[model samples]
Target: MKMFGKVDVGGGLSDFWAYIREPRPHRWAVWGVALALTWVVFSGVEQYLIPVDRPKAQIIYFENWTADRSAGEIRADWIARARETTRRNARKRAEYQRFADSLGIEYDSTEADRVTRETLGEEAAEAVKQRPAPPPRSTLAERAARGPQPEITD
Candidate 1:
């Protein structure tokens, strides 16, 4: 092949090279980017796709809840234990007993009963019969007021 004035101009290679070399926007790339942007705006950024029934759920939970009686039972059990564990006996025992009385629970103050309760099981201590039940607190009206639900929706 010898160099001459003849120009090479056949096939679409020149056009293809020109297209690749230039920084023109392609249709598919532009469409794909627009689709992705729209998807992100609608699906990722937007909220309230499915609303929550928070108030109803909270009301149901509030209805299901009962005042736990175990706390009072635990306190009575601890008091029964404290009666025996001497060293810091008299004053503290008397103070808590008075507090218990104030709370409408009758606590056994006798040292002998305390000893009997500690040595024998609680059944043996049943002879004195310390008030096992605490005074019930909180009427139905107060329990009904669970604060405003944040996600109350139509």
Candidate 2:
């Protein structure tokens, strides 16, 4: 019923504004402290309270139909890729060697290539040795004995 009644609110805000408007020796100091406090509060909220939703990395995978290929075909393709990679690396090394020569820096391209090839070969051998064995193949008779498998529904 008393919507327009005079409520006694403290003059804290008015007093603060008055102090801000009035110039004094410690006015700048107060302003600096206020700014520092504001910065601290905002930085704290940004660093902790705000939920930062970083955009998720979108990964697109292209389907490679290499599974249906024969072992010989795969090996041939791998060898071709290896040769192309070696050629590209050799070209890069030659360019770098030329740059080094221009800069009066000693760079032995042959030695670098030799070392790289040796290390690459060693790693390739290690990888081949560490390769997992192929899964065991099941015969038709075994499948018949096991009976029909349940249909997979999405």
Candidate 3:
């Protein structure tokens, strides 16, 4: 065939070039089939063994490399819980104080007041027995008759 380069009847460098350049159509078809078969095998193996969730895989990999949590976020959550506890405790204490007051029991701040204790002898302190629970006031009409309750200040 004229299309074919000059073939060396004697085996030489030109013969080698011809061997590479003039591959048979059957050989090319075989190579194409081999490539297609390799691709199919690779794709099948990948589908069976390796998961394809790129985003979730990345997050899991990142967590493995780093610690599980952020310290700042944990600290903030703890602080919020503590503040809520403090507020609840303060409200409960206030409610108890109001109940005690209504029962006519004055919180003895005397224990807190060392100066008062030093000035007022033990005998004076003994004089302040639980102020006798005040007699319950009558109804609104009775209170109106009795006039406004006396205002007692500390």
Query: How much lDDT does each candidate structure score?
Result: 0.63, 0.71, 0.62
Number of clashes found in candidate 3: 0
Clash tally, candidates in order: 0, 0, 0
Residue 36, candidate 1: alpha-carbon lDDT: 94
TM-score (all chains, Cα) for each model: 0.18, 0.38, 0.27
Cα-based lDDT at residue 137, candidate 2: 58
Order of quality (TM-score): 2, 3, 1
lDDT of 2 by residue, 1-154 (tens): 9975875456767887787798788988887999999999999999899979999999998977566899999888888787677657765776776677666576655565665556466654454345344345576899999999999999
lDDT of candidate 1 over 1-154, digit per residue (tens)? 8665586675468887786677766956876899999987787544566555565434333443346758888787777676556424543665686688667676766775576567556764564465444556654576678655488789
Clashing pairs in 3: none
Residue lDDT tens for model 3, 13-120: 777778868858797888789999999999998997786866543433334324566898778778767656645654454466557778756665444334333444
Off by over 4 Å in 3: 1-67, 108-154
- Alpha-carbon error at 106 in model 2, in Å? 2.6
For candidate 3, the per-residue lDDT at 115 reads 36
CA lDDT, candidate 1, residue 50: 50
Model 1 earns a TM-score of: 0.18
